[model samples]
Target: MINGSGFEWQESVSQLINVLQRSDFAASFLNSIKAISDFDSAVIMAYGVGPTPKILHDQLDDEYKDAFYDRYLKGAFILSPLYQSYKNNANGFFHINDAAPEGFFDSEYHQKYYCYSGLIDQVFYLKQFGAGVAIVVSLARTRKLPPFSRLEKMALKSIESIIISLVAKNWEKLANDEYKFCDYLNKAFENFGRSVLSKREKDAVNCMLRGSSSKSAAREMGISTETERSYRKTIYNKLNVCSHSEIYHLFFKSLEFADRGEDCDPLSLLWHSAKISH
Candidate 1:
């Protein structure tokens, strides 16, 4: 018997069972969570073998949805606290504040994306399905709402098992589709700068794609933060991109070209265009 802090766990389970049967399981999952503790918005993403996370579902405002998919899913996801937690193989529900790295709010990523989103608080329920595949269901409260209380967290945690089970069953079928997407992305990143960029510049781009700040990338590369910044600038110049958002778009467009079996070389095209503009 399912029990929780004044939540109808059994009903939720029943609904989830029905929802899982549908083709749109992601939307149904989000709805089930909303019934228990209503949040301002929600997002569901799948992470696997790719450098980018695929947004399986989202309920963000239309105005921001494209920006999120184009920017966050493309590159900014690397900087997300929850995404890092998933990388570390962390599972279960967690508040954004709790999972965030030290000085996270002060970071450039927060300023550029999280802060601009106007989402004051967030909680993610993470489930890992081995082989580097995972899904994160994020519930967010707007700036006007209060943070999720302890009781709310407890109630959500109580139903975690049911959620995981439902998602796992659906994911088994979904994995094949995701595999292809991941393969394309992996190849895109692998071949992205092979012809034009130095090894260090490529490494810096990969680090950035994984959501690393200059400091974090520097730490990993055994270089000074200033040196990391220099590498980023050089990479951007070589690629003819000015911002992280543009980098994400470039990666996405390249992957799309690959999927279509086109003979187009997106990087070469971008480089030539940039050169001509100079």
Candidate 2:
């Protein structure tokens, strides 16, 4: 009985059937959702036992999309309120605000990264597969609009079962090959600075790598700008790197080296020497 602007349930069903028959089921599924409800943007992501999240589909603005993957997905995904909810095995539609920690909007990660989207409200339609795997469909509303109303939430909720079924049917095809890069990046983050970098230092580097400025990173970490700058300096000294660019290059190079199955231990002689000097 769902109805929208010239949209009927029968047509929606037909659209879903047609999409399921297509090669790109994920894209088709998103389109089908659009035919039912209007959203400013949407993204479909798969989280697994590993660290990297697999993006199955997205309809975000190009710049926002880039920032999401290049910065947020790299490390901040762990801190994402929606991701945490998914981890807790929470399913169904969730307002982003409802899922976040108290004062999340004031957090630096929200200010530095999430704010870039200019979205005022976000909702995730989450479906969990197992203990460490889940798929999330994120819908966002622009600042110009009000938050999603109860009717809208119900409309999305009504389709939850269908979306879950579609995702379950198509996940193997959508995610199998797309997870490799994230896997590598996760490994790189895990082994790269573990022995030398403190947790806060690593968090700063992760923020920086995703293109946050020192000020932004500092804000996200809930520290003063001076402390942020100090952390950056400490990271540079510990890694024995002269610049942020070098650190960036070193990270990817390590990834490449690891891909080649070479021993790229960051805790070798160089790390010890840097530790001694500091």
Candidate 3:
């Protein structure tokens, strides 16, 4: 049986059923999770083919909203393993650490951007609607709070099907065609290093963007750490940027180039554009 405040199964189902096809579904669903567990906050995001995910609901405190909406929704999400799961059409339950690539915590992703956003740990309940769309309910515990325990995870897993079904039924009309956006982050990230980098090099660049160290990046790519080091070195030489911060600046600079509406390598465009002519 699920734990925490000890919500009975029948009572939980009734509460959920009442909220179906209603705006309160997300809130009720989160409340049910809280009734059964100890998480502090939750966000329901509708993701589709693009990087832009609509925030269907969030019970975030005022303190965390800036990072959650301002930075996370903008583009940093591309580096998220959760986003990777969505892209790969993943379903079911996952603790951030369980599904994340090894050495995820060591990376400067700022705890995959949560370091900056201020979440210590997270769990997800994802339900993919089709080839092109899904909903991810990201449950989090803030700083100073311990992450969910193994027992809690097991309890959540046991009820995963029920959680997914309720969420899916409620948001039944969601579709990828309905997911749309024209944002600089999406365009810039998609085209950032595509021109100057080879396919393998692009993979390396992605790892770097995710803040994976050479050893971890190599481990994920199934290459030696030395080879990963070489890839990073080569990328630095190819891009003429000495540090991660410079690469980031290049990424930001590319957003300006991306504004021109072409999906070409923003780095190449940034260097060659008349706008930057001195």
- List pairs with backbone clashes in candidate 2: 108-220
Top candidate when judged by TM-score against the true structure: 3
Model 3: weakest 10-residue lDDT segment is 1-10
Off by over 4 Å in 3: 1-9, 49-51, 176-187, 256-262, 273-277
**CA lDDT of each prediction against the hidden true structure:** 0.71, 0.69, 0.77
Off by over 4 Å in 1: 1-7, 49-52, 182-277
User: What tens digits encode model 2's per-residue C-alpha lDDT throughout 141-198?
Assistant: 7765677778877787777776777676666444454443334444555566766788
lDDT of 2: 0.69
lDDT (10s digit) by residue, model 1, range 128-178:
877778888888877667878877777777778777787777766545544
Tally clashing residue pairs in candidate 2.
1
- Estimate the lDDT of model 3: 0.77
What local lDDT score does residue 169 receive in model 1, on the 0 to 100 scale? 79
TM-scores of all candidate predictions against the true structure: 0.65, 0.62, 0.88
How do all the candidates rank in terms of lDDT, highest first? 3, 1, 2
User: Runs in model 2 with CA error above 4 Å?
Assistant: 1-7, 172-278
Best by lDDT: 3
